[model samples]
Target: MANVYDAEKKVTVNVLNKEFDLGLMIDSYGNTGFRLNNGVFVMGPMAIFSKSVLCWNVRTVIDITPESLSAFYLLEPKLDILVIGVGNRGDKLSPQTVEYLRSKKLGFEILPSSQACSTFNFLNSEQRYVAAAIIPPTNVALNLDEEFDAGYRRQRNLRLYEE
Candidate 1:
């Protein structure tokens, strides 16, 4: 279903040849942030990636309210899970928003921005029904799967050392 590039360690699915990539990572950023996918740039604090990218003019993670996430309701049929990238670190959501997301019965994984990007890419490449809401992290350069694996290994090593 998906073409796996073992040497490059990236996966590409043959859609309409338009390339439905959910982007790789935050290519460049500033106080305001941005995500880069296939040379297309997105400027914002929050963005939802489905069949297309929905960039939101948010300032911080706290701005993500239930009302702001109404778009996901419409995408319930298209995506089975919605992964949220919580900036450099994870943040707590308002109970109202959390409840609303839960009520929708969509699987959710809240992770750091890099991890979220990695997960989104993996799912998207497999052509799975998935989407992501991400807050771009600043000053971080990631090479999708490689960076993701390295990060995971680093975290794992930390845990092992701690133990």
Candidate 2:
């Protein structure tokens, strides 16, 4: 994947890879985890942050609190939206959390992880600022054999072994 700089916006865009630009993006995802642009494999819950990809310590949707999403609020360039991927299903956020984000002038949406990934990629590719916080699916065995169109597993496996 290649990065192209949008001088007017001062943001690096991944004209080659759709999901990511200057920082990390969700290259592919399985029920258990997501693969990143740089070939890193992140198992369990993760945040596809605009500036970085993080393995969130929280294990379930119930573990996600407003503080768990503080990083989005602190983003330097100010992300326009934060898409929360609630595993295989969409979940509702607490009223307090929604209110807090609204007060900060931050927009958010809750969707299934798969749909969230698509939304993030589309919005980001259009050069709209966006980010995602996703939880790995609870049912890991559901689609264990599904494959990505890019054949990304080879390098990802190699990197896992190297680590």
Give the top-scoring candidate (lDDT): 2
- Candidate 2 lDDT by residue in tens digits, 1-163: 2222222321111122434345666676665577677778788788776556778877777777888988778977888888888776646667787787778887888887777777776666666788888886554322222224123555565688999
Per-model TM-score, in order, reads 0.61, 0.66
Segments in model 1 whose C-alpha atoms lie over 4 Å from true places: 1-32, 138-163
Best by TM-score: 2
Tens-digit lDDT string for candidate 1 (17-103):
234344343333322344344545566555545446667755567877777777766853556778877676646667887898888
Candidate 2, which segments miss by more than 4 Å at Cα?
A: 1-23, 140-163
Q: After superposition, how far is residue 92 of candidate 1 from its true place, in Å?
A: 2.0
Checking candidate 2 for backbone clashes, the offending pairs are: none
lDDT of each: 0.60, 0.67
lDDT score of residue 14 within candidate 2? 19
